[model samples]
Target: MSAPSHTTSYYAASANDKNLRPALQGQVEADICVIGAGYTGLSTALHLAESGFKVVVLEATRIGFGASGRNGGQIVHSYSRDIDFIEKHYGDKAGAEMGKMAFEGGKIIRRFVDQYNIQCDLKDGGIFAACNGKQMRELESKKALWETHGHNNLELLSDTDIQKYVGTTRYKGALLDKSGGHFHPLNLVLGEAAALESLGGVIYEDSPVTRVEEGAKAKVHTENGSVSANFVVVAGNAYLGGLIPKLQAKTMPCGTQVITTEPLSEAQQKALLPNGQCVEDCNYLLDYFRLSGDGRLIYGGGVTYGAREPDKIESLIVPKMLKTFPELKGVKIDYAWTGNFLLTLMRLPQFGRVSNNIYYAQGYSGHGVTCSHLAGKVLSDAIQGQAERYDVFAGLPQYPFPGGRTFRIPYTAMGAWYYTLRDKLGI
Candidate 1:
């Protein structure tokens, strides 16, 4: 029952659910077929199942095998682009609806945990650390924007105040989202998978969908079998390879690295991140860290815009970790891993339908954990004849990277470098 296909992450090592499900062999039928087992697929299928619909999920490898299992684990709110982008580019009405859903994703996660009694070691508190005055000012504006949407569970911490939440003096200040938190991401997905099963939902591992034949009843084909269903949900995110040519062209997959250190003693934990909340610094390419349930410091940062895995993950991450926690110089790193996430030029999630019956949601950038859950609910609402919220997302314009496949990486990396420099010069 071991998940051999899953990445050798700290989460996989400490996974509570190792239940191996059978792969698709023969043709199966369902009300809806979800083509990924990550958060988006699980959330959509689970929501549909709860509404008394027959749901079947086909995972290419294993549950939480993608970014769903291996992320910063911070329950951050809002999209990567934030609400201002929506209001300016789209309109105020779209902005209002998008704003309402901004904080609901985290709430949905908590609701699933309490309603299903899923044991994922959920924790409280998350901080947006600012390394400079300009970043601190940006945090102030971000706080105001969230407040305008009626989300008020936030506190602005001065440099002195942040030192209590984080042991390091790297931050000039921070914005604390009391509703934002962290958890065992893999366990959360596994628990939700169990919750989906409780509603008679079915999931198949090692079931890479080859092609989805579009129709009133789309046929989701895998290597060995197929699923003919009333509707198809394409929720594979970055790992979804050439299945849909149109989708592959609109999004680019990018890699992010994460590492975990040997468990720290109680005193060690107290000295670093005394409040035990997840912390992500304010930078274009950011560094995020938090204390794991067993006291290990799970630190993650850096991005490979081209989706290529770094040759040495520890080399890219260790020095950064030490920069944040110099006291932990020479600390033993127990795990280092890299995973891919989908990104868009606009930095907003791409939600739409293919041929009217096949629905899809992807391109979460780095905010997949929270946004994917909201996507699931919105996608379900659309399928169940409630398309208002879904249209709010689908109506947004989607643009392909300007450089095409040949130079998109360099182009995106160049833009990121420009922003990173802005962060450095405090401009």
Candidate 2:
């Protein structure tokens, strides 16, 4: 088969990085070798490069080919599970450690953009719109909880106040996080990749790893070449496949579809989202929409429990868009696509070492954009002998789907069915 290129999303069409590096051929050596060139790999490599480590990146496909490039682009805070869940399950100390890191991802993103001069059209502000009274109360609780954790930039929005930010009535309330924001995700990753190269780091695209020969020195074998290094990082999220059988049963890939409307008039943009903040509604299977840098509205939702792509992307997402903004009834959809995010049974990301020196961080559920950046920093810290923060995530217990991989889809679908019913009934 031909080496994979990017999907036909808007980001791909507008991507600034078009240079394709040569695939690995002869064996090479580095201080650190990274597998997968999405946010996690690129971020980890960039951090190490800045610290004067000789880092090499191997990509199965193009950089950010996974959900990193094709996501909703919102820099949401926290994990898939909340701080309360972490505190309740892992104890207050763990929760406090996790809490302090909750908002670090967004900050890291801004620093990279500012320091590297990346042109990802970074914007500030994000919204968690509540669909009903119950969700509103949850938002109220969320604001209070997050405040206790030192995130005080939250403001609760009444039904009328929500209209000022988002021109919709579907939400009874909302929570505005000033520190949270959105941007062109693909460009951000590409910029970071370029930054890595600027610091003498190497990235080989189209070089998929076949296996890893473990021992005193870890050798990552690709189709045409291999890399011998002291350490290896597996940042391949959902598209990782079965290269490491041990991780096969630990995560499942779920597809979410996105659609972009043709450029709207300035008036229309104002009527839809006046402040131009990204909005994610409060629902079990929620909908998220944001204004693209080019003035088009990017909206997405609806999970395909399994990794299977749906037949009609526009049909699956457009109605949900209209439900939120009825005035956009006849708007033309410029682009429609789907991407997969790895989901863990516990909804927390799986972070740990594959072996003594092979590290990995995956399964961000629906919050890949922000958390993946955090993964890069924490993973790099471990390589630099600062494993305290990394240990916090690594120490979390990881479990496979109850019935294993084959049955995970059906099992998760049943649970989603329960919550979706609650969403519709507003219970």
| TM-score of predicted structure 1 | 0.98
Instruction: Give per-candidate clash totals.
Output: 0, 0
lDDT of 1 by residue, 137-201 (tens): 99999999999999998999999999999998899999999999999999999999999999999
- Deviation in Å, model 1, residue 305 alpha carbon: 4.1
Stretch of 10 with least lDDT, candidate 1: 302-311
Q: Kindly list the per-residue Cα lDDT of model 2 for residues 22-49, writing each as its tens digit.
A: 8999999999999999998998999999
lDDT of 2: 0.92
RMSD of each: 1.6, 1.1
